[model samples]
Target: MQENQIDHLFQQGFSLHQQGRLEEAQVIYESILKLQASHFNALQLLGVIFLEKKQFIHSINLITKALQIQDNQAPCYYNLGSAQQGLQQYEEAIARYDKAVAINQEFAKAHHDRGVALQELQRLEEAITSYENAIAIQGSYPEASWNLSLCQLQVGNFHAGWRGYEWRWKNSEISKTAGLRNLKQKLWLGAESLQGKTILLHAEQGFGDTIQFCRFTRLVSQLGAKVILEVQPSLVSLLQNLEGVSKVIARGDPIPECDYQCPLMSLPLALNTDLNNIPGVPKKFITCC
Candidate 1:
C-alpha cells in the first residue's frame, strides 16, 4: 500500500480508538502492520488494545516489537509495564515503570503504578515514596493520594494515612463502588459535633473493613450521639451484638432520619485514631459455631 494510504488507515484506527471502538481499531492496526510490518504506531496501539483486552502476552509481544522499532518512547515502556502487571509479574512491571519514569521524569502515572506494584510486593515504604512522588508531580491525582494513604495505613502511620484517605471520596471509581456519589447528605468529617445527633454510619468497602471499624460505634455513642450502623446482610446478626449501635440495618435498606453520615473506614479519621490507640474489641467480635 502507498504511504499515504497507510497513514489514512492509521488515522482511521486512531479515531476509532479515541471513540472507544477497540475491536475495530485493532483490525485497522492489524491491517496497517500487514502493509508495513515495522509500523511503530500500529504495533504500539495494537499492544495497548490487547492490554485493555487482557491478552497480556499478545500485548507484550506487540509492544516489544514497537520498542525494537523505536525504543526511546516512554509510553512503550509504560504499556509494557501494564502488560507485565496484568500477568502478575509485579517485579518486571516495576522495572518497566522505572524505565518509563527514567525516560520521562514527568511521568506521574508511571510513578503511581510503580507504587501499586511495590505495594503488591509488600514493600510498603518504597510504595509510599513512589506514591508521594506521583502526588508531588500531580497534586490533584486522587488515585495516587488514595494508594499513598493505603500504604501509610498499612505501615501504621494513621495520622498521615487518614488525612490522605480523604482523597478516596474524590476518586470516581471508589465513590461509585461505595455508592456515595448520589447521596445528597453532607459527609461528617470529624469536624462536626456528634452530640445529640443521629449519625448514619454506612459500610464502604468489604466485610473485613466493616468488622474492623465497627468498634467505633461505641465511641460515637459515648460522644452522646445515636448510631445507626448499616452493614452487609451477612454481618447484620453479628454486628447486632456490637455495643452503642442504636440499630443495625442491612445494606440497601432505607436509612432512617439522621443528622449526619460517615463511611465505616472514615471512623478512624473521625475519632482521631492513632496506631498506639487503635480501636479493638475486648474479645473476638465473632465466634464461629
Candidate 2:
C-alpha cells in the first residue's frame, strides 16, 4: 500500500515482463493496480502483457486507462495500436500509431505496424509510404520491406515488387511457414539460363498457389529446360497432364534430380513476369466445378 512498496512491486512486475513471464508479471501488475487504481506504468505494462497474450479487449481497456492518466506516453499509444490491430480495427490502430509516431518520430516499429494496418484497409500507397518511413528510420527492417513488396505487387509495380519480394526470406511468419530450401542445386532467379538443364519447381505455399503458378512451367519449358513439378498430393493427379511439364510428382515423394530449383511463387520473379505479359490459364487445365 505504501508508495515505495508499489514501486517495488512494479519493478518486480517489470523484471518478470522483460523475462517473458507474462502470468507472473500480470499478477504483480494487478496487485499494483489494486493499491493505486491510476498506476500508469502498471496499467500500461499489464496492457502490453494482455496484448501479448491475445486478450485484445482487456489490453485496449487498460491501455486506454493508462493513456488517460498519462497522455504523453508514446509506448502506451503504440501498445494501444497493437491491441487494436489484434482486433482487426485497422482504422483505430492507424490513429494510435499516428499518435505514437507524432510523439516520437524515431519509432520504427510503430511506422511499420501502421503500414500493416493501412495495408489491411487496402490503402496500398499510404501503406507503402508508412513502410518506407519505417525503413528510413531503421535501414535493416526486413518486415517493412517485405510488406512494401506486397503493396508494390498489388499496384502492378512488378520491377520493384519482385526485387523487394526477395526480402520474404527475412520475414518471420513467411520464413517459419515456407522457409528457404537448403538445396544442393542452385536457385534460379532470372539470372541464369535453364537451357539444356532440368529444373525442379516445387510448391512452397498453399495448393491454390501451386495451381496458380504452375502455368509458369510452360514458360520455363520454352526456355529449353526440362521441368519437373512437385506439388501437393491432392493436386498430383489433377496437374499430371499440365502442358510442358515432363513430370508431376506429389510433394514428400522423391524429387527428381535437377540442376536448378525454384519455389512456384518465386517463378514470377525468376521468369521476369509482368502484368501485361502474365501467362494465361491454359484451357486444358480449366474444368468447371
Candidate 3:
C-alpha cells in the first residue's frame, strides 16, 4: 500500500476511536499493520486499543513492537507500561515508565503510572515520591493526587496523604454528599487539632479503609474530644467496638454539631501518619464492643 493510503487508514482508525467505535478502530489499525508491518503509529495505537479491550498480552506485544520501531516515542512507552501494568507485570511496567520519564521528565502520566506500579509492588515510600513528582509535574490528574495520598498513608505520611486522598470526591465513581461542614473543609490538612472538640470522621473509600482507620478514633478521642464515625452499613457493627468512637451514623444523614469533620481517609493526614505512626488496629476490628 502507498504511504498516503496507510496514513489515511491510520487517520480513519483514529477518527473511529474518537467516535467511540473502538472495535472498528482496532480492525482498521490491524489492517494498517498488515500493509506496513512495522508501522509505528499503527502498532502503538493498536496496542492502546488492545489495552482498552483488556487484551493485555496483545497490547504488550503490539506496544513492544512499536517501541522497538520508535524508541523515542514517549506515548509508546507509556502505553507499553500501561499494558504491562494491566498484565500485573509491575517490574516491567515500571521499567517502561522509567524509560518514558527519562525521555520526558515532564511526562506527568509516566510518573503517575510508575508510582502506581511501585505501589502495586509495595514500594510505598518510593511510590509516594513518584506521585508527588507527578503532581509537581502536572496538577490536573486527580487520580495522581488520590493515589499519592494512599501511598503516603501506606508509608504513614498521613497528613500529606489524606489531603491527597480527598481528590476522591472528584472521581466519577465517588458519590458526592454535602457533609455537615462544607466539602472544602481542611480536616485532612490537620489545620486544627481535635483537642477539646467533637471530630466527625465521615467514611470514605472502601469498607476495608473504614475498618483500618477506625482505630484512629481512640487516639483522637483520648486527646479530650468526641469522635463521631460516619460509616457504611457493612462496617458499622465492626466499627462500634473501636476505641474512642462516641457515635456512628450512616452517610447522607444530618449529624449532630461537631467542631471538625474529616473524611475517614483523612485520619492519616490529621495525625501526620507515617511508618512509625500508622492508624492500625491491634485487636479484632470486629466483635464484642
In order, candidate lDDTs are: 0.90, 0.90, 0.78
Q: Write the per-residue lDDT of candidate 1 for residues 100-132, one digit (tens) a residue.
A: 999999999999999999999999999999999
**Range of the 10 consecutive residues with the lowest summed lDDT in candidate 3:** 280-289
Ranking by lDDT: 2, 1, 3
Residue-wise lDDT of candidate 2 within 1-289, one digit each (tens)? 6899889989999999999999999999998888899999999999999999999999999999999999998888999999999999999999999999999999999999999999999999999999999999999898999999999998878878988988888887887666567778889987898889999998877777888889889999999999999888999999999999999998789878899999888889988877656789555654421
Q: In model 3, where do residues sit more than 4 Å from their true spots? A: 156-159, 170-199, 218-228, 234-247, 252-254, 257-259, 271-289
Residue 71 alpha-carbon offset, candidate 1, angstroms: 1.3
Question: Of the candidates shown, which would achieve the greatest TM-score relative to the real structure?
Answer: 2
lDDT per residue, candidate 3, 27-131, as tens digits?
998888888899988888888888999999999888888888878988888888898888899999999899988999999989999999999988987887898
Which lDDT value does model 2 have at 134?
Answer: 97
Q: Each candidate: how many clashes?
A: 0, 0, 6
In model 1, what are the clashing residue pairs, if there are any? none
Clashes of 3: 6
Off by over 4 Å in 2: 281-289
Q: Tell me the lDDT of candidate 3.
A: 0.78
